[model samples]
Target: MTRLRWCLLAIATLLASVLAVPPASAAQDPAPILDPIPDDPAPSGLGLVLQEVARLPKSEPSAPPTDPRLVRWNRINHVGELPDGSGRLYVPDLNGKLYFLDKKTRTPSVYLDVKATFDPDFFSAAGLGQGFGFVAFHPDFKRNGKFYTAHVEAGNALTTKTPDLTPQPKTGFHGVIDEWTATDPKAGTFSGTHREILRIGFSGRIHNVQQIDFNPNARRGDADYGKLYLAVGDGGNGNVGDNGGDPQNLAVPQGKILRIDPSGTNSANGKYGIPADNPFAGQAGKVGEIYAYGMRDPHRFSWDTGGSHRMFLAHIGEHEIESIHQIDAGSNLGWSEREGAFTFRKDDRCHLYPLPADDAKYGYDYPVAAYDHDPPANWDCASDTGHAISGGYVYRGKLPALRGKYLFTDIVDGRLFYTNEREMKQDPTGQKRAQIYQLAAYDTAGNPVTMKQLAGDNRVDLRYGSDAKGELYLLAKANGKIWKIVGTKQYAGCKPGPKRVSHVAAAKNWAPVTPSKWRFPGREVILAEEGVQRPGPRRPFEYAVLKSGPVFASARIDAEVRLDTPVEISNRDVIIVFGYRDDTHFYYAHLSSDNTIYPHNGIFVVNGADRLRIDQQWNANRSHGAPPAITDEKWHGVRVTHCAGTGEIAVYVDGGARPVMTALDTTFGSGRVGFGSFDNIGRLRDLTVRGTPAE
Candidate 1:
């Protein structure tokens, strides 16, 4: 018998119990689907309950590094709990220190330093994927003092050590995986014996070794017990080089999820064993270590502690899509061949096309839940806009709002995103994957905030961490800060009311914060002058809220506005106010000339502090087309409709049937409606307000 057929036969009984995947059939791609990922619709009343955790001091590099990723506030990535029940948490910095955090006190102390103790030649000076990337504790760590880590080393080290797998001829760096046994597992600082277990050479630094983990759900007697899964990237082949051959190749470990028994010995390395039931364990000409192949950068992966216990890996895409694939034994996540559910045309890197008619012949796997980098972001495929996807857990925590949801985020923009766990399903045809959604975020003071706002940096460089109980935490490299997900907070109340009431055009009934700055020009109310005229009391030129007419819990404002200022201005905007509780809080639709800037052309909420954006279609388009809400000097018909119970707010421009902007927020309910401009003179005419009066 052939070696491949013999190996398959030997593991057939074992495979039935350990792995089950659908057999490949011609019916897989009857109707290929190729469509831009849908924009997240409706604000989830649910938002993250973020409580401040410890902040690490900025780590200045010993020498200046030219690469942008190396010049960060701090380079911390992974936040993990030690396998022991001591409640100790360990966070690693790419600059070389492993910090041990105290759960009770919420303090951090250095637990280990790679450069000082392990290897001085640790190369963390440059490269996005270089340095201490990930760490995982063995399930038996409490008893064995065993844990594993993946770190980067300089290419010069290639002279002394031999790599287990070297896919490329010319190597740029090495991603090393090591096994360490601590003298005292419960100790604060690490004092241990370490040995190199596996080393993989990469031709490029980016997307080298992104994550290393164990099946946290697998118990001692389970079939997956001691298997270590390494998310090895394509060595920058399939992504930047636009060459998919290496990842699609089965002979090498690059661009593959490799699974091996860390404690067993039977493989070529003699340090790890290939599980007997591994789909390709002893298959001919194929690497036994590969669990699944064809990936770009499998940034992170996790197993749902409860439910189906299926493995999910968040993949950072080369162009448009950022995806999370449901991994199965012998599965191939088509990378250069496919990006998410769409067929990837490597030569045409900017666009994604439909899968080919014979897609089933390749037996590729598509993401169960995926999202794109545009519409919600308006990012170009070539640049560093909203591209990375940091994987998060299928929350099995007690937080009612976050539970049963797979929470994730954009690594660069710090936008929090999630997909319903119940909705993630693998479809042979690329038609019905889960729709991704955005959850609102508020601080301890109950004011809405974005990661960019909290970190004071545009690039949050985000990552996720979890406790033994499955609760998650947000870690950022931008400000070296960590925030724990404490509970849930809905910014607005969902009680709908206020019977139909309408009022129109009565100058005497209008109430503006600065009556002097506004003028009643016949039938039109003109913010005829800027706030600069009044120096005394110094009324902020922020937004004009007219609390006259009818107060509402649910409200609608239809108005015609004309900016008297010339079109030369880049930041001029008109604001429509609703859900106004008082001067301190309310919601507003900011229609501006520029949509690319973060603060302009969107819906926002002022919850006592500064205004926070709540709009999903913040920048729906750039050079590829969609226009900003209002960019001309002429009059535009605008409408703002808010539903109190559902916290749905949509703003339409120029009588368009669909909202130019949309946001979900419950920060305030049942308040007055009004109009004004942020900067420059604007007049609101033909104004009408209709709503049920606030109870």
Candidate 2:
């Protein structure tokens, strides 16, 4: 199997094995299965209606602030801000280059090239896994220049007379935590000194250790300055023996958050000393480093601003949940015992040991916020569609607009919500009294605004950070865009210009594409098109096609079209009349720049005819045969007509009736048309795209 496939399989197998084992605690009564919420009903009316409060006025600072420039990196899994006011973004790319972003410039530069810094054989021998963790700067980083990282390291072979069945060779440490020192403390960059702090072995990648965060509130000048809090996921393959959720276990460090002082001592394996205050430091068999235990996939977590009595952990779950737990020493989070307030295995027969009724609450830690699979509010966890929760810090910054709010987001849903400590405490019983408002839209001035509807919703995991003063920043996962929530009051009520409808004709120089004409709700737009005479070398090309609606569409072209290069018809529609024509077919539909196809099922052309026809019996399909013949070498007029009720599609080529098909559903809805090579090459000309909303 491919490496990626192997990794995925390993992860799946691990999860299965971990969860398949019966929980230690089994209940006498049958487990309570919460009733699923109705799909169409409005959200439960239990919470405070935030809409009833007066809307906060948009900030009106004199000079509008500039948009924060986004830093680009390969597979940025997490980000953390230094206490010294600088930001460090960690990318666990396959190649293992650690990147640092300068908060001021929003530019990314390599902080540490693991390949160059570590012994090359380390990875070759250990069999490096995907870079899946984080790098944390010491609390007193200004003077200490110490930072720590958690990552996968190959482990030594487990020598048994009988061979193991798992794919992992008898060799390799699945995960390791390392501490390094910067060469120069005064320098603004990270290319200074280096050191290996510690290494912990794991079985595989899944449930590997994720991040290490320092207690921001820890004593600054004390020996604890470089002491760290490490969040380790249940070590790969969810084996109960990994001791993932059991805080009492001593043989394994799989599920625990470890506390250590990097400068303290040297052990048989490496450097770093365990803090005496660590929960289990003096215990006989337990790893002295563990601070707390009982967590699933602790992908990301953070200490609140000002660091007093608050920490957030985003725990990944299997079915029905993802949670944010508040940290406390010796906390038993009930991983195999429970998943986010719900019992996973409740039958007494399923377990060898029974846990207390309040297992998760027995220890010092508890989940501050937890949600189930319900929609319109909590993330859709039951579907297992959401992957991980990306924990974020509470916004305790200089920006008056977002101060005093706890901001956290899910990596899978891209939803941002804020809650007060009081509100979070009240959500334990699956009942909430506070409204979690969606951060719907941002005004042009960059102020947050509640929209009539949510837009641009996608699975863009948002990474969070804060500056020295604790101002909040967001890193969008989809495009690596960075947005700073700033106060702005300058609003120019400018209307958009007219739409330039065709690619065959040259775009009028500097013409404005009006918001109304372009059919987008936004205030600005620019229209441009390019046509190539000769086919370029086969390569991926990114293009933006504008449609007069809410969606953007894109596509790739491997071959030619209309007697040019042979175009492969990957996407097609026979129902909509006016769409792009590839070599094999005319789309007869509007496509968004993001590759969303919309069918305008109103118009159609008689099959094999040179006459335009409006037919209600048209059907849309991907395999509708070759596009109608084009008379000219370049530029052909195409029209699509759709009938919503009849589910018909008609296509006209150069105003001549051509093909008609019946759509399985309504073919047309009023929306703009966007066409171009999504990630590959193709050409366009004479594209007159228009739309009217479905009435």
Clashing pairs in 1: 491-666, 491-667, 492-666, 492-667, 498-692, 499-692, 552-670, 553-670
lDDT of 2 by residue, 396-507 (tens): 7765545555666656566555555545552334333333322333444332332211213355645565555665655553444455555422111111222223332233
The 10-residue segment of model 1 with minimum total lDDT is: 531-540
The global Cα lDDT (0 to 1) of model 1 is 0.77
Query: What is the C-alpha lDDT profile of model 1 across 1-695, one tens digit per residue?
Result: 69999899879977885556554553353333323674443345567878988898678543578867667888889787888898888898887788989979879999888756546557777777778878888999999999888988874586777678745657767888989999999888899899888998888768888888889888889999878999999888655453447788888888999998889889897987889888888988888899998898889999999988989999998767888889999888887688887887656756777777778887788888877766334445566654589988999989887778899988998988888888999987766788676677778866667889887788889888999999899989888999999978653433334444334445675677677777775777788776443333222364456645457877777889887777886678778888877766777887778766766778888777777778766543432212477778888999888877556776778887446666767778678776766667788878766666766
Best by lDDT: 1
TM-score of each: 0.73, 0.54
Off-target runs (Cα >4 Å) in candidate 1 are 1-35, 61-63, 239-244, 375-381, 494-615, 622-695
Instruction: Specify the highest-TM-score model's number.
Output: 1
Overall lDDT per candidate, in order of appearance: 0.77, 0.45
